[model samples]
Target: MARVALKGVRKDFGQTKVIHGVDLEVADGELVVIVGPSGCGKSTLLRMVAGLETVSAGEIAIDGRVVNQLEPKDRDIAMVFQNYALYPHMSVYDNMAYGLRNRGMAKDEIDRRVREAAKILELAALLERKPRQLSGGQRQRVAMGRAIVREPKAFLFDEPLSNLDAKLRVQMRVEIKKLQRQLGVTSLYVTHDQVEAMTLADRLVVMHAGIAEQIGTPLDLYARPASTFVGGFIGSPAMNFLPGHAENGTVEIGHGVSFALPGQAARGDVTVGIRPEHMTLNHGAGMATLPLKVDLLEPLGAETLVYGKLPDGLEVTARVHGETQVAIGSTLPFSVEPRHVHLFDKASGKRLP
Candidate 1:
């Protein structure tokens, strides 16, 4: 329903700057997820858009209207928080209808909206039940129903599924995605869970230390990360970094361990990045091999994680088939393709050409 945009958005607490200048646009009916570790300013950035926090600088616009001076209620946005935030004494119907009632809406219209939302959320049967009588998933549905009835211009979600169990989290995640698509509301979601971010977002903003490290589709960040931090953060097992020197179209990771570069790289000290999944046990033509002294093994059904150290004492991990047999203290050769290797500037930690 509405386009939300932030231009040079920033935040400051006293003299400390917690959010650097961040600019983003959430297109109408698009879902943009902001993901990062804790203290990365993701939540703060969402709060600024919702008018829950003051914009120390920059501008926030909703539906082409500047709202830096507006209050949260005037922003025409609904927020779903991590905590359920339900009223224990009030039944589900009343909880969903409370906001409309306060706005002095006609009783009949309020009833219609509440019942419609309840039906969509599959909470019609639980409308009379109090929050205390509902399961965690049911309670979360009620919260979502309450927000849906508002018909706001945009929706803001702050780690909405964090408090649920693992299984419930997955279930709720699917439901949220479906509901958002059905409603077609522009949404900005903040979460520390990368899996959720990758699955739910149309686009993702990866933040770090109050700065947005990269903004792109999930697969784009995974395949062609803009920096070492992004290379290490977006993937499941995380990319491994090794100190190396690059010169003459080749990189020497350690003494007597080197690989030819697929393309030109910075001509001096560089960090070599390799994804665990990219390493294989088979020695193929044009593949470079590294001697790994196995230190630990984790068997994960379909795949096993081999944790070990290279001959130079640098730690590395490899994801291998579960059936592969190996033991501690044994040295196994792991091979990597030259094209799968990544290079970064050692001093700046930025990806190199």
Candidate 2:
């Protein structure tokens, strides 16, 4: 329903800078998720947009209005916190309607919004229950319902699903995605969970050490990371990095293992990146093969993860079919397509073309 923009936005606690200059534009109805590990300034960025933290520099605009000088309540945005911030003594209905009442909205209009949000969240039957009588998921829904009744210009979520158990987190993930799509409200979500970011975001901002490392679709970041840090952070099971030297159109990893480059690259020391899923058991013409000394196997129903070391003591991981049988201390051949290989500058860790 609104467009949110941050231009060179920054935050500093006295002389200690936490958020470096960050510029982002969230188009109306698009969900942009900021994902990174702890202490990466993700939550700080979200709080800046919500007016909970003062901007050290730069501008934040919501619906085309500058809000750096505005209070949180005047920004017309709703925030859902990690801890379900609901009054324990209030019924679910009253909790959802509290904001509207504070603004002196009509009693009937408040009732209409509350019931509508409850029905959409499937919390209609539990409206009369207090926060103490609800499950964690239900309490989260009540928090969301509270935000929904406000119908704010934008929605800000600060790891709203972090408190739930694994199974419940997945369920709530689905619900949150559906609700966002159904409402078409512009949303900015911050989470350390890459899986959640991949599933819920239209676009992802991969942050690290107060910088936005890469901003793109999930698959784009997976296939072409700009830096080794982005490469290691964006994917599950992570990409395997091998030290190698490149020259004359080839890279020699070590211990007689070398492969032809798919394209021209900087002819020097580089890190070769290969996703675990990109390696396979079968070799094809022009494919590079590595002899893996199997150290462990993790059978995950549909697939298994193979953890091993190369002849030079470089560790590697490969994902293979679940039924594939292998034993510890056994050596196996793993093949990698040259096109799937990623090359990064060893000194800088930036991707090399």
Candidate 2 lDDT tens digits, 1-353: 79999999999999899999999999999999999999999999999999999999999999999999999999999999999899988999999999999989999999999999999999999999999999999999999999999999999999999999999999999999999999999999999999999999999999998989988988899899999999999888999999999998898888777888766656989999999998888888877789999999998999999999998888999999988898889999998988888999999999998
What is the Å distance of residue 106 in model 2 from its true position?
1.3
Residue-level lDDT of model 1, residues 1-353, one tens digit each, is: 89999999999999999999998988999999999999999999999998889999999999999999999989999999899798889999999999888889999999999999999999999999999999989999999998999999999999999999999999999999999999999999999999999999999999999888999988888888889988988877889999999998999887678898766746999999999999889887877789899999999999999999998788999999889998989999998988789899999999898
lDDT of each: 0.92, 0.93
Worst 10 residues of 2 by lDDT: 257-266
Off by over 4 Å in 1: none
Summed over model 1, clashes come to: 0
Q: Where does candidate 2 stray beyond 4 Å? A: none
